[model samples]
Structure formats: C-alpha cells, structure tokens
Target: MSYKSHTVLLIPGIFDRGSSLLRMQRALAEEGFDAHYIHLRYNSGWHGMEHLSSQLMAKIEKLVKKETTCTLVGFSMGGIVARYYLQAMSGINRVHKFISIASPHYGSYWAHFLPYKGGKQLRVGSEFLRGLNQSVRVLEATEPVSIWTKYDVTIMPHSSAKLEIGTSYEVPVILHRLMPMSSKVISLLKKEVITGMG
Candidate 1:
C-alpha cells in the first residue's frame, strides 16, 4: 500500500519512553500515513528545549525526504520542543502541519516544582517562552493546531494549552499524560492532519 507523502513525526512528552505514542502510531499506520517516533535523547529536557529540538531536527533531517514535508504532532513538552525547532530552528519551512496536544504554550504552574533548565523555561514568564510567543505567527505558514483537555492537571490551569496562533480543540480527555493515547485525541489528529480544518 502506498503511504501518504508527508510524514507524521510523533514527539513524545516529558518522561515518555516511546510507548506512550504507540497507539497513535498504529492508528496512523492503519490510516495509510507515514508515522515515526523516536525516544528523545533528552527526554527530561534538562539540557533545555533547544537541545531537545536539535535532536528532533537531526532525526527529521535523516528520516524525511527532501521532497516531502512533515507534520509534527508533539505532546506536552514535546510540543515546546517542536516549537523551538519551528520558531528558532527554522522548522516552519519544512512542515505542512503543526499540532500540539496538551502543550503548555503559556507556561505551566506545575513547572515551579521541577528545578531544571527545561522546567524553568516552562514557567509562566520565562524568557524562552516569551520569545516564542511573540513570533508565534511564524507557524501560520503551516496549518497550526492545538489540542488540549480542560481536565489537564499537569498544566495547572489547562487554558495554557490554548495557543495564540492556532485553532484550538478541547478534547474531553481526563489526564494530561494520557492525551496522546486517547482515542478522541487520536481521532482529532487524523481529522486535523487530513483536513486542516478550522
């Protein structure tokens, strides 16, 4: 069977070893899309979002063909990693669609407990996020989409998942970490990736 031209790169969230995204990958495969996910080298993001983003860039460079664009589906902090690549690493030009699921685009209160460069950057008013928020318009080149749940405890004020530059969908999923594996979220992804709907 012929697969879709654009690849769907699944970037797992913090603490995700890889299995978190298997269901999504399987769904995409069954739908005839090219899907791939690698366990991030800096899964904890201790080094910083840029470091994690660089790793994503390298994988993209190796996996995607020059003729093909990619669709990025980042879960939680994985979303921030993808944004760093898009806004700072010039990844917007290479993407056809950008999707962030349960990501803290506005920073998370829960980040206060995690004392690390990556966690600090995820705080409510970090310079890293400030810089990215200012230029979120860049993602407009690709059809940017945000998926979040109202019950997300990890984001502490789940509205943080609503981005300033994209269409936001509120799924009824209960937990933040389970978003990528939720059938509702997966179905939403399929719709967004295929239709780019508003």
Candidate 2:
C-alpha cells in the first residue's frame, strides 16, 4: 500500500479538454510522479460517457500491466465519469486512490436551469445524476480520499459537492473553474495526495 510511485490519471470537467488539466499534470510530473490526462470530447450530446469511460478503462488496463496501483484525479463532471467507471467497469482494481475536486456528488441545481436543446438528456444532475450519486456513494466509500470544494458555483446548493463517507477536504475560498490551477488548491491537493498515498 505504499503509494509513492503510483501513476495518476487526471480527468477533466465537462466541456473541457485535456489541456485544462495540463498544469496539474505538469505539477505532478515535477513531483516525480507519472501523470496522464484523460481528454474527453464534449458536445457529443452527453452520450459520450460510455465511449469516454471505455477509453479511460483501456488506458488504465495498460497502466495496470506496469504498476500495481493507480490514482484518479477527477474534476467536476469528470469525477462523475470516474465514479461511473469504477462502479460499472470490472477493471478498477488498479485504482488505489480517488480524488474528486468540485464534483457534484449529489445532483446539481444549475443543470436543471441550463437550457440545452436536449435539456436534461444532454447534461448531468438530472435523474441520471441522482441515480449516479447513489451508486457513486456506495463505490466511493471504499476509496481512500474524496476531496471537495465549498464555494463552487457550477454545482449549486453547494452541498451537492460533498462526499457522504471517507475523508473529505473542504476548501473555503476557491471557485469551481479555478480549482485546477489555484496554488492554494494545488497545495491542498498535494497534501491529500500524500495522505492518500500513505
């Protein structure tokens, strides 16, 4: 269970690219950790979760061949996707730690308000999110750490961003979009990473 040399898979939020997580990936690399970014395509009308999850699982399978343990760094919707991957996929044994930043562990209120052509079908936090949360809660409780932010606007009601069990970190001032690059947030994350790895 010594986690010092484990590979970290960084997953980005919704409507985002791998470049969004580049800074953090570089930071982790600088710390002498193996970091990989999962780039998912948005605007596939939200039906891309299966495809994206499959891609992630494939990458993880490859990593498992080399390492005994891995860590997942998921932000926002990417956290949800990570949860789904852990719950539904059979290849999650390689993941030793899971850290979520500003993710909607519960359903988000803003998702109900956003106007999309496909509406609830095209976004998270609808009935799908509610069910996803229930499932995630069961799976996440087995993980080592689950981090959250308090001042997130993207996931309204703020409470939606909390984890029901496991060690949760609540940062007071950072917003959702800035969570990836904030120095304070990165510092907090490094601490959690060390804690989880231990």
Candidate 3:
C-alpha cells in the first residue's frame, strides 16, 4: 500500500535531454517515489513524434515486466508522447496515473511558426496534430489526472493546454520550461500522485 513504491517515468519536452526534469525527479525521490527519466531525441526533426512515441512505448513495455504500476510525468511535447503511447500501445495499462505539465494537449501555435522541416508536423491546425489531440482527449477520459498550466509561452492560445476529462490546474505564473521545477507545479504533481494512489 506504499505509494512510494510506484515508479515515476519522467519524460522531457522538445529538444530537452531529460535534464529538465532532473530536479523534480530528485525532489520526488526525496518524497519516497522512485523516479526515472527518459530523454527523447527527435523532438525537432522529421518523424520526431513517431520516433519518440515508439521509443516511449518500448520503454513502457520493458518497465511493465518489472514494476507493478507506474506514473508518467510528461513535460510539454513529452506529454503528447506519453498520451500517444498510452493510446496506441498496450503496455500503458500498467501505468497507474498520468501527469502533464505545460503540455499542448490540443497542439501549439509555436509549432505553426517554427521554421524546420518537421515543424509542420506539430502545427495545431495540421490534420495529424488535430487527430493526436483527439486521441489524447479520449485517453484523459480514462486516466487518473491530466494537469496543465495557463501561463505557458510555448503553447500559445493557452486553450491548447487543456485536457478533455480530468482535473486541470492552471498555475498563473510559471512559463513552459520552468514548470517542471516550479514549486507550485511540483506540489500539484505530488497531490495528484498521492490522490491516484489513495
């Protein structure tokens, strides 16, 4: 019954080496949770979403064999990756909860403006991105919690930060990257994790 025994998989956002979640992971560990980080490499390249989603699914499959249950803590694009994995892969059933911080559940305007070969792949208006958002909405309906931030700069048109059917929190002062380390964000995550376990 010790929730601390559950492992937390920390997925980092676009172009992030997973270093972004290090402080938060350590803090979670201090609170008696087992935390691990996944560094997604193709957040800015062609097929970035596909590549990361496949990698995350593989990791979840591997973890399912050893852990009874897990929680996914995804940041920004990482949240999209986690949602896709849960929806498309069967390994996600082993997960007990999901927590997203500053994630673009509905796609982001920044992707529409970025000048890159794969930039269009992230556009909120793109057919692919819109479809992915729909899938995430369905997943949120069945998951424990889906947290978001209102002051995110990366996911402009802040509405992109919302999920369909879960508790949504709006922290008014933190930016996108800073969310993973913000005290308020951490507290929210801690509360969600505890609630999920209970």
Candidate 1 deviant stretches above 4 angstroms: 1-4, 196-198
Which lDDT tens digits does candidate 2 get at residues 33-90? 7889876755232564556677778878776554476788888777767776777775
How far off is residue 67 in model 1, in Å?
3.0
Ranking by TM-score: 1, 3, 2
Q: What is the TM-score of each candidate against the true structure?
A: 0.94, 0.82, 0.87
Better of 1 and 2 by TM-score: 1
lDDT, residue 118, model 1: 95
Instruction: Tell me model 2's lDDT, rounded to 2 decimals.
Output: 0.68
Q: Write the per-residue lDDT of candidate 1 for residues 83-105, one digit (tens) a residue.
A: 99999998876787899999989
Model 3 poorest 10 in a row by lDDT = 137-146
Best by TM-score: 1
Winner by lDDT? 1
RMSD of each: 2.9, 3.2, 2.9
Residue pairs with colliding backbones in model 3 are none
Clashing pairs in 2: none
